[model samples]
Target: MKVAIASDGGNVAQHFGKCQEYAVFDVVDGRSENFSYIPNPGHQPGFLPKYLKGLNVDCIIAGGMGQKALNLFAENNIQPIVGISGEVKQVMEDYINGKLTSGASLCTHPDGQHHDCDGHC
Candidate 1:
């Protein structure tokens, strides 16, 4: 299976849409195959889902994602694993080791600011 992880430098981005790049990792039989980094195409409504789907990503791992983004991913048959934060390599390794477990989102859009966070306060 192929996994796309939302990343910024060495850590998981706080927001999926604002991530600088995506580290695409391919896993076969519980072993990681190869990995590559792709620049974020764009952060438009429903755009990310299409972009990731085009890459044949089976799942998306990220620090946080809003409900709309989650819905879009579901619509495209892409599973999202949110509330994760750490180095891209570690995340991938955890996945390969069957230690990564997905839970609820860890972020909340305070003050109704749904958009334009852009990785900064």
Candidate 2:
């Protein structure tokens, strides 16, 4: 499976659409490999889902995502793992070990703004 983690520097970005880049990984037999980074093309409504879909991404990991983007990912058959925050490598390890669990969506806006979470990401 191909996984894409919304990233900023070496850590997971707080918001999917506003992330600076994506850390893409190829996983096989519960192991992750072929890790690479892809620059965020830009944040446009409905654009990212299609873009990642075009890249053949099977899943997305992020700290938060708007409802519309989540729906778009669903329509594209991409599993979205939200409410994750940590170093990219550690997060990937957690996912590989099946220890990662999605929490309540940190973003409340359909437009991908960081308006919720009580200023605590």
Candidate 3:
């Protein structure tokens, strides 16, 4: 399976729309096999979903995302997992180990307010 994690400077970006890049990880048999970074094309309405689809992304992992963006991913046959945080590598590792789980989206407002309480992003 191939998953893309919204990233910024090697860590999970808190807001999907503002992520600097995507840390794409390819997993086989629960083992990560490859990793790469694709700089974000841009975050215009109705753009990222299609862009990620073109890359054949199966899923997207992020700390937070707006509902519309999440729905767009679903429409494109790409799963969106929100409320993930921390270094990109460790986040991917936890996912492979089945230790990561989606929680309430961190950026509920999506109006650019109070999303990064921890200031990691």
Prediction RMSDs, each to the true structure: 2.7, 4.2, 4.3
User: After best superposition, candidate 2 residue 104: deviation in angstroms?
Assistant: 1.1
TM-score of each candidate structure, all chains considered together: 0.90, 0.88, 0.87
Clashing pairs in 1: none
Q: Which ten residues in a row have the lowest lDDT in candidate 1?
A: 112-121
Q: Is candidate 1 or candidate 2 better by TM-score?
A: 1
Residues 1-121 of candidate 3 have per-residue lDDT tens digits of: 8899999999998888788999997989879887999998876777888898898889899988777777888899999888888999999999999998898787755565544432222
Name the best candidate (by TM-score): 1
Q: Order of all candidates by TM-score, from best down to worst? A: 1, 2, 3
Report the C-alpha displacement of residue 87, candidate 2, in angstroms.
0.3
| 1-121: candidate 1 lDDT, tens digit per residue | 8999999997888788888999998999888887889999877777889899999999999888878788889999999999898999999999889888877665457665554643221
Candidate 2 residue lDDT tens string, 48-86:
899999999999999888677888999999999999999
**Model 2 misplacement above 4 A:** 108-121
Candidate 2 lDDT (Cα, 0 to 1): 0.87
Each model's lDDT comes to: 0.84, 0.87, 0.84
lDDT of 1: 0.84
